[model samples]
Target: MQILNVFLVIFLIVAAIMVERTKDLLSAVIIFTSYSLMMALLWLLLRAPDVAMTEAAIGAGITTNLFVVVISRTRRTEK
Candidate 1:
């Protein structure tokens, strides 16, 4: 469990960095969604189910959807 926690944290960090480094806006949004999901999972592992659910719902679901919609209505590539 401890090892899994460490791995998830590492993955979360990498995902966050990827989100920032990605040249494509859509790709960055997708990575951000993934990072949010990972955060929810980490919360679950830490025994905070309520926070996990909130994170999953708001961070991964609603926010991601909003970002995708906004991105689709604007542009796909970055400068």
Candidate 2:
């Protein structure tokens, strides 16, 4: 579990960098989705299924949709 925690932390750090450096909104959103999935996995490992479910739904699902809608609404930002 400790080793897994270290690995997860590394993955999250990489994902965060990817999210921050991405120029395209859509790519940033996809990285965010990956971050959310990682959060869910961490929650599951910590024995918090409820939090994991909420993270998955709100972070990965609804948030992604909202990002997509906002990106669609703004045409100038598209690459």
Candidate 3:
């Protein structure tokens, strides 16, 4: 449990950095989605199941879908 938490935390940090540094908008969105998922898992492990579910639904689900839609209508790479 402890190890899993630590790994997820590290992945979150790296994903965050990658999202910011990435030049491809779609790639950034993918990384951001993963970051949200890791966050949701962390929240679940922390005993905040309600918050975790909300984050998973909103952060990973709705937001990612929205981003992909917007990206589809525009350029996929940063200029």
Q: lDDT per prediction?
A: 0.93, 0.89, 0.96
**Residue lDDT tens for model 3, 1-79:** 9999999999999999999899999999999999999999999999999999999999999999999999999999888
lDDT of 1 by residue, 3-78 (tens): 9999999998899889889899989988998899989999999999999999999999999999999998997998
The best-first sequence of candidates by lDDT reads 3, 1, 2
Pairs clashing within candidate 2: none
Give me the overall lDDT of model 1. 0.93
Error at 79, model 1, angstroms: 0.6
Best by lDDT: 3
Q: How much is 39 displaced in model 3, in angstroms?
A: 0.6
Off by over 4 Å in 3: none
lDDT tens per residue, model 2, 1-79: 9999889889999999998887888888988999999999999999999999999999999999998889888862444
| Best of the two (1, 3) by TM-score | 1
> Candidate 3 lDDT (Cα, whole model)?
0.96
